[model samples]
Target: MRVLVTGAQGQVGYELLQRVPDGFAVFGYGSQDLDISNADQVRAVFKAVKPELVINAAAYTAVDKAESDAERAYAVNSDGVGLLAAAAENLGIPLLHISTDYVFSGDGDKPYTPEDVTHPTGVYGLSKLAGEKQLSEQCSRHLVLRTSWVFGAHGNNFVKTMLRLGSDRDTLSIVADQHGGPTSAGSIAETLWALASVFRRDGRLGWGVYHYSGAPACSWYDFAKEIFTQAADLGLLEKSPNVNAITTAEYPTPAKRPMWSVLDCEKLVDAHGLVPKNWVQELQTVLRQLGERQSV
Candidate 1:
């Protein structure tokens, strides 16, 4: 089966490129190759590839910046997704779209299920929610995977940021009130591969929304401390930074983040018969990769 992957240079997309299983042809496109925001370009690419499946990883993911740039965020996140869905719908192909947990207002301690009401608090979340809605409305065969706190080897993510900051500063303060799992893009990509492989054989697997992330949930402060700990274990940190916990208000941003945005993976687990690894274990593997790269 032929599969098309967008945002090929991104964290998740990069991992997808690396982890595509045997017996499938994967074609990847970065922003320079195919800008999904352009309907004509999207149509052209779909026409040429005529892929059996399309995984859309392209997105405008600047959470704080989206507060001021709502239009661009919507164009890339919502409109781009709509374009891809339209193209796939026209071609009778399944579209697997990536979404976010930021769609929730983040007010409750309980993990948000697929049926939970979405009340995005910022432009980024609003745009992503719009994209999810568009995919659901436009395509009959679509899988909208809503994930959170994605980190991976090949892109700008919290793990990389914390690693850099841990080396640069002796003390760091991260918001403790916010809670969610630190998902690895590699894991998400692998799950997508599994889902896509199944969907290719049986189209029944490519409908409805699913939530996935690392097994356990944690706060941003906790995640940072874990990153430092892992880095120290890998001998990557020269000087360990004292990561302090602070309230969201203490580190105010233009965008309002959800205090509790953890997603319950029960539906995904049941649907795909899959399980996510512990977040700390995934973090350690990532740190090991980073250490290897630095040494190389």
Candidate 2:
């Protein structure tokens, strides 16, 4: 079957392009190639491709920057998703859209489930929630897969940032109070392909909102320290820098993040019998890919 993907240059989208699996035609469009916020362009692309399935990876993901650019964020995150959902619905195709864990208030004592009430603390989260609503209302068949803390070899994500900073600075401070999984984009892509395969085979698989992220949660400080450790062990760094743990208050940002962004993956396990990848183990692959790219 043919599939169309947007935001092909992003962390998750890049992974989707890299790992399309066999027997599936995957077509992708970057921001310059397709402006998702533009409804006419979205419809035109759908008309041209006429894909059997659509995976919308396009998003305005500048969480902190969304505070200053709510209009842009909503346009892409909210309106663009509606357009995609509607197009997929009209074409009688299935749509799988990526969402964020920031949809919750982040004060949950336990990990978040798909049915939990949403109360986004920042503009980015709020806009993403709006898109979720749009997709549910507009599409007949849709899969809203919500995830968190995505990192990859080819994106300006937390891991890449930490690697750059840790290599240059003697010491760096990361928020300890904040806890979540550092998910590898590669794992998410593979999961999507697996889900798609199941859907193709069954054509009546589970569909709706689901939560998936890296197994085991850790604070930002923990994730940073791990990055340094693995990088040094891989010879990417001569020595690991000092990672100082600090509270969120010590380092303020334009957007307020959910203190605990951990999401439960049991629902996905029940539906697809798939568990999330252990990020610690996957980090090695990411670092190796990045290191190889750098050497090239």
Q: Which one wins on lDDT? A: 2
Q: State TM-scores per candidate.
A: 0.98, 0.98
Candidates in order: C-alpha RMSD to true structure:
0.9, 0.8
Candidate 1 local accuracy as lDDT?
Answer: 0.90
What local distance difference test score does each model get? 0.90, 0.91
Instruction: Please state the error at residue 115 of candidate 1 in Å.
Output: 0.4
lDDT of 2 by residue, 181-247 (tens): 7899988898888888887777755889998899789999989888999999999988999888999
lDDT of 2: 0.91
**Distance from true position, residue 90, model 2, in Å?**
0.6
Candidate 1, 1-296: lDDT as tens digits? 99999999999999999998997899999999999999888988888888988999999999999999999999999999999998899888889989999999999889999899999999999999999988989988999889999998789999999988888899999999999988999999988999987876676683898998897898999899888887887899976799788999899899999999899989987887878768899988888888889999
Model 1 bad stretches (over 4 Å):
none
Worst 10 residues of 2 by lDDT: 198-207
